[model samples]
Target: MRLRNKPWAKEEMSKYPHIVIPNPKECKGNWNKVFGNNQPIYVEVGTGKGQFLSGMGKLYPNINFIGIEKYDSVLVTALERIKETKQENVKFLNEDVENLLEFFADNEIERLFINFTDPWPKKRHEKRRLTSEGFLRLYEQVLKPGGDIHFKTDNQGLFEYSLHSFSKYGMILNNVSLDLHQSDIEGNVMTEYEEKFSKKNMRIYRCEAVYRD
Candidate 1:
């Protein structure tokens, strides 16, 4: 996916310090203070346009939703969406996935969502995939025991690789769906990419991988 340069993105993002967290790393273990409540926090990596997080926040008002996106251009759009929704429980971090641990401490996050992430398909780029072992280890450190990662993608090879990766890491998989839209799963929030892919009749793969103690 090509990202068009939005020269005003950075300047626009600064306007909403409440929605776009300026210093996420400083909040680390004190995310409850940031949200001013003890509600469980759910994070979405590579949150493009903030559609999923916004929708989830509306459905689950008791849960705090944080979105992490590296690109200022992409993240600005998500920030705008959250502002329009006026969702107090929804926030964003304009940060990289590699620095995930820096923003949250052990057992801080309750759940994670990885939806339609870039499928770095080259064998050489396997480590860059969000479902790769390195990322799984990072997730394990931050999420509470029994926390689950909900993942969805339209890429078949990446889906297969992720299933194998999850099993290799000893994570228990559940609710695996090769065609999510056709499945019986309820309350599934659609991301911008998921909606576009569904319109094209593409199969959406989804699964939940739980972390064990």
Candidate 2:
């Protein structure tokens, strides 16, 4: 769903400062302090509409969840969902994933989630894919040793590309599913895209990639 430009997105975001970290860099290595507790942190890159992260936050209050969306318009929608749910453990970041290192310290994140990200299908734009080696290296820098990335997508090309990419990086892969809905994967939190695609009988691929540095 292509979102239209919202001239009021930035202003609307200011209304929810508590749910959106005002100065993310200040929290950096001290992310635990942002939530006022030292709980495991989980982050979702390209958190489209906050369904997954907000659900996870509400379900697992012990873990802190942050949703990163680059566009202010898209992020405001996520923030709206968070607001409606009144989810305290979840926060939204209006920033790019490329600058992930600038927000969190080394080994700061426990788990990373990438769901239905842009495939960047063209060969010329391979590097723009979130699962590209460059992003994986960046993920490694922030993820704790043994921490893994959980990815799901309806794009077969992206999933295949990611599988090879993870293997190329020597990441241990497990629980790969070609059709996630048919699998008996319990505790699955549905993202907006997941719900939309699954209803259309579209196959959803998922996998876990552990970076054992």
Best by TM-score: 1
Query: Candidate 1 overall Cα lDDT vs. reference?
Result: 0.95
**Could you say which candidate leads in lDDT?**
1
Clashing pairs in 1: none
| lDDT tens digits, residue span 1-213, model 1 | 899999999899999988999999899999999999999999999999999999999999999999999999999999888878899999999999999999999999999999999899889999999999999999999999999999999999999999999999999999999999999999999999999999999999999999887
Residue 61, candidate 2: Cα error in Å is 1.0
Candidate 1 has its poorest 10 consecutive residues by lDDT at 76-85
Residue 110's lDDT in candidate 2: 95
Q: Against the true structure, what is each candidate's TM-score?
A: 0.99, 0.98
Candidate 2, poorest ten consecutive residues by summed lDDT: 18-27
**lDDT (tens digit, per residue) of candidate 2 on 40-76:** 9999999987889988998899999999988888888
The positional error of residue 8 in candidate 1, measured at the CA in angstroms, is: 1.0
lDDT computed for candidate 2 = 0.92
